[model samples]
Target: MNLDEKMLLLATCFLFLPYQIASVGIACILVQAFCRHKLVDAIKNQTGAIFLYSFIGLEFIVTILHSNWTGLGNTWLFVLVGLYGAYYRKSITKNTFEKMCDLVIILSIFAAIYGLYQFNQISIANGRTFLEFHIFNSPKRRITSTFMNANIYAMVIDFVCVMCMYRFVKNDNILCKIGYVIVALFNFFVLYLTGSRTALLPFVLIFPIFLYCVRWKKLFITSIVLELCVCGLVFLKPSLIPRMSDMSTFASRIKIWKTAFICISMYPLFGWGPQTYKKFYP
Candidate 1:
């Protein structure tokens, strides 16, 4: 891989680090600045890009006014990298995109394999079922993998599954197609290991869209099949839907969303400064 490819690969990997994605993103920004890269040129001609930066700039100003330094830095990393990507969006060739997708698929497969190891280790150490292996605040055991959180792992696997599905359908190379299938199957297992219902949303939503792209009629049929599969799983493994018996979490989430809306209403323009809600929310 070339320098740009290597940079993207490294950026993707570092993004998994706990509270480190922003720091690495800052380093990326510094590199771009030092290299005299036309960072502004990234979004100069795109109206949507300009609007994006406008919103981000407004948020930055609000954070500064509130003296929310952590929020400012946090927002800076994401917005800066987004704008930078917009600047260089056209530079990423199709070949580069494919290669990056391949790398991502491979990474997900490895992450799933490692998660298997972590899951087994936990089960062995506790001599108990995964249901009893406490993970964070969740009510059940969650395979956190190396991400340190099952929810994050679940979301990552779901995202990877989507990517792999895209390549799986689009690619003609037999070997690559096979690899995508293998990666996708493993992702489902790993996603289940995370015990996250969130994983179901992306697959259920994105798979139909993908099917629509490939064959419109297949979308409906495929969705029905998917729903049946989910029902079948639920029938076979009632434990999979742990939250079905517990509505406390569901209630709390609704309450939290209401509180978030209230907070947003209070700060219509800035919204209590970025990342400050956790500290300030009562």
Candidate 2:
């Protein structure tokens, strides 16, 4: 890729703004799509098509609601997904996909190891402390992985863990399976370090669904029942409850949604152009 694209890829791990990485991803996808036109048509029939379209559509809605579309380049995530769908046309290059999976695994492992080191007071270069592990103003560290914040770091690791586990289950190699075990342990450590209750819930709930996809129908059904039980218990037991009801934390999100709703109401047709949510929200 060019220098700009390289910068975008580097920016992906920055965490304060993932849209930068998304932009690069979109660019890659678009480049691939142009090279292979058939993939665009194929994308239309995929299972997550509705959700994907809706997600993109909602961004426009938010822009219209807020009457601002500045810095909207970040929404390239959808474009990248589209590109990815098309680019993997040649199934013969299974190694490429495995490599991508491996990259994610490596990144997560690096994050975990770095986090551990940071916690242990292992000095980094040039007076740059690992900010992810810092708790509040006191420096009581929390493992933020490499994303600069523990929760986001954990989420990234969780994502990688899922992908790696899926690949491990499908692949026949013993070494690959062992590598996945390492990835899983590293991911689990990072997840625990974050102490994000909300993030952990989805991980537990999605396990059975993921297994079900791999032909474990009975396990899938059991997971559904177990998920319900988990939810019910969460509602009933005050002490065991997850932090899903923190109004102050989610309040800004509510405002953002409300603002988007009002903007969309005002300009339901054509929407407020694009990337206007931040401008309007502010």
Candidate 3:
């Protein structure tokens, strides 16, 4: 692979790492872009480049108008990542993309293992059983793996679980299929340990559609049985699924969303400025 391709792979691998470490991936992309001197061509060749550039421009305008410089750095980083994606898309081969996906799956599995280790350590330190750790301490005692937050870790696991499910359905090799299923389940359990209600929402919404698309009768039946069992467990002990017993989280989310909509309505065209939502959210 060329330098750009190598940088793209590096970036993908760094995605699940802690933010401090992940900054290296962003630097790699920027350095590669500068070395290649093809950034202008990359912008020109990318589809919807105009819209992205316009959005960035508008963000800058809004930032200036509101004097909210705190978010401009993030805005610039977002632009850089988008530009790098366009360049990577134009240059990447099918085989390289497949390799990148495999790397992502491998990294995700490692992350899940680490998260499980974190869970075990925390449970031991607190003199609690695994179930107790999740039921009573979760959303507070949740594992973050390499990321800074449990919710972010859960989101990443959610993506990997979907990819593993897809691979399990499509792969012809029985051994490979079994491996995918094992990895998927492993990551999914770790996801549950995260106590992220939002992350679970997508999985609940997607599983039926996925089963329908694959049309595997045995698998579909198995999933339904598993779902019913899980529902029964939750019904008996709502705390078994972390945060499910708590209504306050739902109420807080609704309030936040309502406030966010109100803020957006106040500045319908451009946002009040990136990262300014907290300041104006009340």
Candidate 4:
């Protein structure tokens, strides 16, 4: 890759502005596509991308026809999905995918460190720290880290944790194993502080999967026992024990999904033009 492309790839490491950086890179890819014949190849060879972007293109046209002013500006971004396929073809190499995975890990590490910094930045008030841990009940507040919201932070937090866990379980090198274990623990701590109830499910499933993949029955059973002990501590919180009975927390998600389904039913061929759900959703 040239210096320009290298810089664009480097921009992907910023966890706080992932979408913005990716959009910039997509712009570069589009510039390159105009100068060469690769754009034709992306359409002809990448049928899946073509299908997805065709719908996205339809949505943009529909939004203009409907005069939906809310998400009209952002509607152009849907084309980037297909553009990325073109970008991948521009730099065909096995290491491209591996390097992308590495960037995700690096981005996650930066996010975790920022979260810890945010945790310390909170000043104690009335002799009580704001960073409270409630394993079962909903937390009073959540740490957003560098993201716009804690839930957005939660979505990307698992990337490094799962990566480290796989390395810790499969690596033959003892030093690498130790390093990955430490990173994995730090990821779990950050995941907890995010206070995203749904995000916790990854660790619940990841640990068991890693142990099972290692192919040691005794190790798997021992890990389960240790996890159960941790769960017992959380169970002491009464609300945590009956979280399923408390359905109030999922109200926003249910409403969002219902709105999306209604919109899709109304316009089955295309979505409500990218982020237009915010405008029309009840």
Best by lDDT: 3
For candidate 1, the TM-score is 0.80
TM-score head-to-head 1 vs 2, winner: 1
lDDT of 2 by residue, 95-161 (tens): 5555556666666666677777755463343244555342221223455644646667767767887
Kindly report which residue stretches of model 3 are placed more than 4 angstroms away from their true locations once superposed: 121-131, 135-140
Off by over 4 Å in 1: 19-22, 33-36, 121-141, 146-148, 216-223, 232-242
Evaluate residue 188 in candidate 2 and report its C-alpha lDDT on the 0 to 100 scale.
74
All candidates' TM-scores? 0.80, 0.56, 0.85, 0.76
Residues 151-252, candidate 4, lDDT per residue (tens digit)?
Answer: 678777776777776556556889878877777788778877676767777667777877798787887888789888868877776345324346776887
Candidate ranking (TM-score, best to worst)? 3, 1, 4, 2
- In candidate 1, what are the lDDT values of residues 1-282, reduced to their tens digit? 656655656656655565465466747654674375645555665558767777788878888988889888777776756665764473466777777777878777767888888777677666765556433236345577667578888888877888888898779999989988888888887676666776666776687777777876766686879788987998788656634445557878887888788778888766746787776455
- Give the clashing residue pairs of candidate 2, or none: 29-83, 64-272, 65-263, 65-264, 68-276, 69-274, 69-275, 69-276, 133-142, 144-150
Clashes of 4: 1
The TM-score obtained by model 3 is 0.85
Question: lDDT of each model, Cα atoms only?
Answer: 0.70, 0.60, 0.78, 0.66
- Model 3 C-alpha lDDT per residue in residues 1-282, reported as the tens digit of each score: 887777778888888877756765676676668677866677778899889888888888888888888777667766766777777777688767766776788888889889888888888877877666543334556799998888889888888888887777666899988888888888888888887877987866577668977887776777778887877987899877777767766777788898899888888878766788778653
Which 10-residue window of candidate 1 scores lowest in summed lDDT? 133-142
Candidate 1 local distance difference test against the native: 0.70
